[model samples]
Target: MEYLKVEEGDQREPVSPTGQFLNSEALSLCILGVLELGVPISIDESHMDSLVKDVFLPTNPRFSSIMVEDENGEKLWKRVKVKIKDHIKTPTFPSGLSPKIYDKYIDDYISDIATEKLPVTRPLWQIHLINYPTSNSNAASSMIFKIHHSIGDGFSLIGVLLSCLQRADDPSLPLTFPSVPLSSTNKDSNGLFKKVSRIFSVVTNTVSDFYTSIVWSSLLEDDMSPIRSGVAGVEFRPFSVATVTFSLDHIKQIKSNIGAKTVRVQAKQIQLHWCCSTRGNFAVMFPIKEMIKLDSKTPWGNYFAFLHVPLPKLTDDDSTSYSNPLEFVWKTREIINAKKSSLGVYLTGRLLQVLKILRGPEAAARYIHGTIKNVSMGITNLMGPVEPMTLADHPVTGLYFMSVGAPHSLVTTIMSYNGQLRIAIGAEKGLIDAQKLKSCIEDAFQTILKAACDDDT
Candidate 1:
């Protein structure tokens, strides 16, 4: 892997706090990987140039500027710069093709991006066009995009890219780039009292909002208890063996049947079904409730907790179906409700406190690695149609995003694009067999699709 430094004195700004949180660690890792794959992809020269040029230039806050004190004790945002390397032309892969060749290329690039440091000089993002073999006989390739977590969170980055693109046929017109509006607060002012007051206000609000979330979650609902841990030596796992997709109508029906009072009922059922079907050992389902508590004070991005839904052991003749899954669903709901009191935020704060004590980024890195295995997977469902997405003038047929799996065997990601729900599952290499997981996911999706179709008819 090659490293590029951004030139000193160039100005560029960091994204907002919400954007920073979203673009933070996990998202950043994925972006870096995608950017490394950009070399061989079909990106237009102009688009690529715009990405590098617009993204790297100086900003109001000057992203390269880090706050520090001078010898005389005056404090200021010190600007630092670094250089960037051109794309490597030499073949990073071996001469002949082998089994799972795509995996080799992708994995090698992933590792390279993961280890590379973000340049302090420019905005921390990269774009790489991947030229890779695909199953389609008509088209020989595919494209991947890599971005840094510090640049923007997933949604923010998606929004940024989408803004730059037009429909394929309309691509001839120059796309308009939207400038991010400045925050109301002034950063250059030398008033120490104002700065301190702002910091205090932010902390106070965050703490208050966190407590409020706990109260709402607690008073809101109840779920079943989760399974206790056992001593079984964990086996290495790979991608999911099965996945199921529910149509919008089907999900709505489930909500109507369960409790028409709240949209969360459907989420409850999905989590319950997965927990019971896989047995408690396979994974736990958590409903992300952070979005529901949105208020003026609440954080803008993800601040939800995963309330573990424990599955009951299935008997030999047990049939896993949508109706039966409701039992497990309600149980998980109870767990979520139980923690709705201050306990949820308290626990989270405690965890964050532990993380803080670790000291330094390396400690944070270790913390993430150690925590992945405690849960089997995560699933997020957004209620509405996502804004349409396209690439190189071609409307995207489908898209799904999954974080690279933690130490855990697998993670499943689901989102609705256009009118269709898309799912992507990630798993570790040795733990779960990829083919088996793929088959299982396909089977699950088919089952759900068929069930939805029948219900519609």
Candidate 2:
């Protein structure tokens, strides 16, 4: 358990024992799963060497290092080495292997690797290049990207990876590796103490600053509280899960049309429509409609809520058409907006009940362990191309990434980068046909794209 020096003026202060519980979905997913893809393209050893040396080396910190204190209490960054694993096998699908088999491989790999202990010896990333047999008895290649979460968010990690490529034939260009500082050893006990002291001081200051700011701002802020009103007072029912995707352009257009600033609006529309159509219960909703109202009455923590969105039963005279879909989507957006305007409080008194049970050590352990059984799907959309990325000197054709959540029912991740919109869905073993889900999601995205494009026509 060595510590690293913090660089001056860095926002993150050094902490003892370094690692913290993942607080964001993007970070958690990067740490929890590997990116496995089959590449129809191949390169020589020198090219692979260049990719690893230039691309992998410089971007190592996004997943490898922890912030720690030095004896003097200055901030610094530590770099972790990414791990590489090799498995030689035969390929089967035209894309190099069948999606079903590839997904199974991913499941097994994640089960084997997910853990809390941060690797101390190498960079916190791994690469596996599989050169295996094809169904045609010819060799095919695949690449696996395994990175830890603490280093950077999903977007940043992907950016680092893409930085490794040049144009397909322009490998001769000098590599532009992201600059990183060298790793330094903790040398003495005083260094550790100083780091701890600095961390304590920083935490104290932060709490004080937050308290003062909030107190002063309270005098001038308006009471735009969250409203709890919706098509409530209706019975809730279980609904079947379905997914849809929209082209990046259409998503942008919708955002522009709605004049929304954040993805919360989009997510709310989805929740509203699903509730209206199926009258089903939702486990959770973000930008909780209740948070605004209850901020002063409750603890200032994330206070989301779950409710049932009841749908009207379909009549024989009702027809499913493009008009119907548009109407449903529009109505859902309206309901969400109406709820947003009226303040409503979410009941969080249950949390006290949970805390009471968790007061005991045994009970706390039991509760934490129980999370393994209570998995729920989470949807996170990383909208649009922030930047371009390449790999192995080849322009990226397409990119997709996903993370597996606990209880493992299904977790959907959507990201649009470089003119491509990608979706990755994780499911429990034997619970979902990954191929079918993939197709459904693709179809959904296509449907949305067509609708948007048709509007243009």
Candidate 3:
């Protein structure tokens, strides 16, 4: 954690409380993106280098720095001279890598990058660009960077990516997003539950579920499957990336067939504690662990929570009773529906406060780290732009990313781009085969797509 040789004009800023919390475990968030450039287009490696050096480096000077502990043992950031060659790497693929071979190279590249920790001697990020033919495009290439988790969370990182970009067509025009409100208004607007009714519901429903969750976590673990390593499993394992692509229209069809909105909303309002991991989401019928705190006031840096949701055993015969492809989803809906009214998430938020009060902040942070160690696999679903995006005049066709480490070996990331929803799976190499997991997910999704829409759904 000591500083490397001091550099000129280097300024040190104390790592935020959240950053300190993550630094305790030396975890980093690595973002891997696959950019699709359609047809054949000439790309100068020097131009790409200059673009990052002049545009990207100036836009975020912090990217030209490293994280180190100062004399007082405080986590601090110090600026360093930007090294274009060290930061932007150009990897070449064979002349005839056939789409499949190229894909394998990509998988290997991601897996290798996912296991790499950012060096404290250089900037916290690095981009690896490969001039190769992608299954989606010929001029396409991939850029994978290792970012310290302390640097920022997904939301902030996405913001940074958008900030550097303007409307592809007109560089002068700023990129704008349609203002669509994500969350709903206050419950009072519904004119539904009065104060007295709310009190009664909280006392009866919320209190009861909180007590039940306590009993559950204290007693047993959420099913022990291939993906879940259980309490005794190896906690510190390396990670890898796996990917699967599904039809966006087909997913919507499944949603229509089964009032999926009603299912998710009902689950959220009722006994639900629905949360997501770098991989995916599910009910956390366990103890509270590491969750991001309310510290998003900063312009950019990681201020996020960690929710580890286990993957269900897709090959289990017991889960195949229903004929619909969405049987897994419907079955999951039923399981979560029962606990929709629970106050688990609310109680979880209070856990750190209670611990900080009784045991101290350091103790509370340790408790957070300890609780997340038992988690084995993670799942994430990301929604992206319906239309393609261009970077430096080249259209970006496909994009993807993955979280490097979280004490858990397996992490799953899903992003829907254009007409397809691409699911990227990250797991420890020896612990689980990324290819097998991808196959399982694809098979399950296809099974649902091939089934008929039942009237009951």
Best by TM-score: 3
What TM-score would you give candidate 3 relative to the actual structure? 0.75
lDDT of candidate 1? 0.40
Worst 10 residues of 3 by lDDT: 266-275
Local distance difference test scores for all models? 0.40, 0.39, 0.55
Give candidate 2 misplaced runs (Cα > 4 Å): 1-19, 23-50, 60-123, 132-141, 166-323, 331-375, 383-389, 405-408, 442-457
**Candidate scoring better on TM-score of 1 and 3:** 3
Using lDDT as the yardstick, the better of models 2 and 3 is 3
Worst 10 residues of 2 by lDDT: 226-235
TM-score ranking, best first: 3, 1, 2
* lDDT string, candidate 1, 31-141, tens digits: 322211112355556655554445433322323343333343222334455232332222245545642565556555543543454453343444444455422212234
**Model 1 misplaced regions, further than 4 Å:** 1-47, 55-123, 133-141, 148-157, 166-343, 350-370, 379-387, 445-457
The prediction achieving the highest lDDT against the true structure is 3
Q: How does candidate 1 fare on TM-score? A: 0.55
Q: C-alpha displacement of 178 in model 1, angstroms?
A: 22
What is the alpha-carbon lDDT for the whole of candidate 3? 0.55
Better of 1 and 2 by TM-score: 1
